[model samples]
Target: MKMMERLETFLVLAECGSFTEAAKKLFCSQPTISHHIQKLEEQFGAPLFIRTGRTAQLTRQGEIFLDYAKQIEQTMLQAGSAIESSMKTESSIVSVYVSQYFANYYFDEILPTLHASDPPYRLEINAYCYEALKQALVDRKTDWAIMPYYPDDDFIRSDFAVHALFEDEFMLVLPPEHVLMNRKTIYARDLQGATVLLPRSPFLIRSLQKEMDRHGLRVQYLQMSNFEVIKQAVKSGLGAAFLPYRAIRKELEAEELTAKRLPFFGYLRQNGVLVRKGARFTAEEQAFFERLRPHFDEGAPAGRSAFS
Candidate 1:
């Protein structure tokens, strides 16, 4: 048990990259975290981390040990699951991590129906940025992740099972009184001299730059970190933005905002659900996945080859 505690502390410290943050997460003191890490290094016969200022970076040996530590955690989880199944006790709770857009726009409405079914499966959903979403799966913290997929997204490797979902189209969103609101179609060239509000997503920014360059338009950009903030910026008449249709669906319907097709290709944002390739799903988790299937686009065939 002491060794297990040490390994757990090591994993958390690696994940956090800071002993102070790891201590806060584990509800322990910094000295205790240091003690556990020191013991791990002694058992492994090597210094695991190279400590700098306030950060702890894994050495080559530490990187190798991370995989083994994760395997131990996973094995324990499986053993617990097996014991719980034998006892036929508590319901299964599956954890899913998703992007903020999905949480705000889609899942709020979908969760109710999912929770109401017979033999209702317990679900634990956490939302994070795209990078954190991927890390959660790598660390085995979450069972699945849902996020926007891009053509250049190389992270969806062979080790992942991907279900390519719908393409959320990027549209030109405008305030009701904007000059472009009266235009029949919003073309890329038409964006000349227009200030465009943009989210800080690297993929979206790169795509936007490519399209702008293709049209030879030197448009002004106001970069924001939050999607809600981008939407409000457009609504406040600060600038027009290119956002997914689902993101502004309600505003368009209510006439608080106006949306137009981008009048060119390569504006679609693909999305997908991903799980680790060899995961063993309990009956309840499988049922929850089935319930979610009908709600999303029924386009992608099951077990589609990695997101390409």
Candidate 2:
């Protein structure tokens, strides 16, 4: 608590830019604010402030420490909220980080149903791209992350406990009038000399590129991070893209876009749940994960792939 207090005080002082103003905001003495900053500087073995004019300015070291100070402040606030929420609701809230596509396609439907289930458990979903999702897991901001499996991904292999939920096969999406629209199976070479709309996330983008390059296909890209944006871009005839079938179920069924099976485009992205290494799951958390399993691959063909 004392460490948190010091950090909170430092954050206020940094924001207010004056010891007196910070003290006024905190309802503490100006001397106390000065003392707190001094203590932090001593602990870090550097000066935190440059005392000049009316407002105190952060030194180079203080600027670097500001980020950590802010993080500590946020953690403290979440901790307080958790305690209050537990007392009122008696429900444990689970924080989850989901990929943009998974959140839009599945979480949109899944959350409402979960909320109304018997013995309801609270779930908070934070949507991020692959890189941001990985960082959220490592930073412990989320209890679990729902993301796609990428080849040689160290986050899945080393730092987290993973469960293979289901496979979501990619569908090649093209405008209705495209040349490859009638093809039952498309090859990577078919995409050569064409612009492929893909997410800006490095991991997923790299995964897409690697598979194409494996088949000696070269292509241009119209890159955007969000699935909806890419879907719209494909619809606008920007270019063709490979996307999860579940995400574009309506579009596929409505014939808003044409989908072709890409035989040589062989990257089976397995979506899974990942938790920080060695974190023990309570019964509620375990049940929540179980409840979501059936909905994991809604795109699965009746007898075959999850993303049909």
Candidate 3:
């Protein structure tokens, strides 16, 4: 009996030209739809619809009133949008969480491009270590992430939504002066007895370890918490690292860090965007993603995980 409900029902019935179809759209019984239409007709003291055997046609008065109903609907939509925006402002914190290394290495250039948006919003770049980033998404402390892909798990599949951001491949990086850089084609034998720097993500570590064990390789590993640190360490001859090539391209171009042409054994890492399922992205969040979408233009993921 609410004004908007009655108006919406009338609009649906008019558009469908059938009481039965309107009932289905509105998820109500046909009689309920009919009764709603009847009440509106009586209020205006005019036959709004000419019901003829499961179909309805709007009369002249009904046609005239449809304009007013549409205007009301538009107004309601605007009002709802305004209310939602205001509510978001009152709670006022928009943030995208990711690994600190990703925030600096990957998104640093991509994020600054958003500075020209009208009615600017403050998007907090909440950076954390790998384990903390996963927990934050699971706990709903943050909504969106700009990070590498992780295989789906119970919490990820059930509670979070995954978006494949880009197809990335791991590169073995060493100092430019390292002996491995002189090799024409790097192989597993080249990495024998080397100290490999690794990120703290369990999934990546596990996947890499499995591959190493399968390949019958033996190497000393040093676990690092950030990509930048790992890169810097490799550049300083502290150790070598398997990092996403796209992430460390600047270092490659500048000849600061050297990438060995070792076979990764078809292990391609997929970068991804993770948000809590059913979370609404802010305007800035949507725009930031659109700018970065070109990198992820692999069409669709051919594989789910690095090894899978």
Give per-residue lDDT, candidate 2, residue 238: 89
Q: Rate the local accuracy (lDDT) of all candidates.
A: 0.80, 0.78, 0.76
Model 3, runs deviating above 4 Å: 1-93, 118-121, 280-288, 299-308
Cα lDDT, model 3, residue 47: 94
Each model's backbone clash number: 0, 3, 0
Candidate number with the higher TM-score (2 or 3): 2
lDDT of 2 by residue, 122-176 (tens): 8766888778877777777765778886757876677765566777778788888
| Residue 246 miss distance in model 2 (angstroms) | 1.5
Which order, best to worst by TM-score?
Answer: 1, 2, 3
Among the numbered candidates, top lDDT falls to 1
- Which 10 successive residues of model 3 have the least lDDT summed? 299-308
Best-performing candidate as measured by TM-score: 1
